[model samples]
Target: MSSENKIEPGDVVKLSGAPNLHMTVDHISGNDVTCIWFDGSLHTISHKFSLSALVLVKKKGH
Candidate 1:
């Protein structure tokens, strides 16, 4: 990913332009980032999203 948006594995992130939706970073390559999260479902299926349009989420205690 870009230096401005450094997404490491285990970091919680969300789409920069979307709200109320969140995901965790799995892997990052160049300007793309792989995120995994659950999409409201009864199957409990994990959804993987590859996006370059992402923003970082600050964890508590920095």
Candidate 2:
């Protein structure tokens, strides 16, 4: 990852292999990161993913 492409806590990210599903990075521990997203009913869903699996969501007009 490049300097500007770094993923930090609170940044919205998605799985690089699984597109479209947006998630937020809660925290990171070594090679794993905790992610959270809301489901259809607005329930909070969370999981830990490999640090490499996360791709930062880019803002429009960047």
Candidate 3:
């Protein structure tokens, strides 16, 4: 595999712009990525965002 970052299911990700809390990558279709995260009220929220709109989160000190 190439030494490049790639997003996959189960990976943690967030919005490229206006990032807040991180979301889990539930799935991907074409150019859309399905993300799931909990809201302030601890409610599960599922949303679809374009791949270009998401950034693969790299934890510090990997």
Candidate 4:
């Protein structure tokens, strides 16, 4: 993915191939990422995912 497409905290993203898997970026580390869902759920995913594995929804305006 391009630098502009990199995920940041508060950005809303959906797992590209997963059904109904949406999350809000909560934190990002070197290769590990964390997110919170609309239902107050938290998850961690690998940053090495291909671009097709994630879709950026809403960006954090701040």
Candidate 5:
């Protein structure tokens, strides 16, 4: 991973292996991260994933 790819909370991300899903970073701990994505109902759904599985999509707007 490059320094530029560093992930932080509030950043929008897409899994490199799963392009169809886009999620937002809610929390990170070591190599694990808590990600939240929208469901068909538009409800926030969260999942735990490896940090390495994600790539930055869009950083949160200030």
Candidate 6:
């Protein structure tokens, strides 16, 4: 994972950079981020990013 990549909560990540396909990261890890789908499914993505690439959208509301 490059230091340039910053992960945060509420970030709408582009899953494969495809139009409309995305996920929101609820938490961030050292080299991976934890994401949650509208269906409540959880996933962990690496900072490197790929077809499952993700980006920081916004911070989670307390």
lDDT of 3: 0.83
TM-score of 6: 0.46
Q: Per-residue lDDT for 50 in model 3?
A: 94
**lDDT (C-alpha) at residue 40 in model 5:** 93
Q: Which lDDT tens digits does candidate 3 get at residues 23-61?
A: 988888989999999999999999999998988885323
At residue 52, candidate 6 shows an lDDT of 35
Go through the candidates in order and give each one's C-alpha lDDT.
0.66, 0.85, 0.83, 0.67, 0.89, 0.53
TM-score each candidate: 0.65, 0.85, 0.83, 0.60, 0.85, 0.46
Segments in model 1 whose C-alpha atoms lie over 4 Å from true places: 1-5, 42-52, 59-62
Instruction: Give the TM-score comparing model 1 with the true structure, all chains together.
Output: 0.65
Candidate 2 residue runs with Cα over 4 Å from true position: 59-62
Per-residue CA lDDT of model 5 for 1-62, tens digit only, reads 66556788998998989888999999999999999999999998999999888989987883
By summed lDDT, the worst window of 10 consecutive residues in model 3 runs over 1-10
Each prediction's number of clashing residue pairs: 0, 0, 0, 0, 0, 5
Which has the higher TM-score value, candidate number 4 or candidate number 5? 5
Residue-by-residue lDDT tens digits, candidate 4, 1-62: 67678787788888877657777777776655666664435345434343346688777884
Q: Pairs clashing in candidate 3?
A: none
Find the candidate with the highest lDDT and give its number. Answer: 5
Candidate structures ordered by TM-score, highest first: 2, 5, 3, 1, 4, 6
lDDT at 56 for candidate 6?
A: 44
lDDT of 3 at 2: 33
Candidate 2 accuracy as TM-score: 0.85
Residue 21, model 1: lDDT of 73
Ranking by lDDT: 5, 2, 3, 4, 1, 6
After the best TM-score superposition of candidate 5, give how far the Cα of residue 20 lies from its true spot, in angstroms.
Answer: 2.4
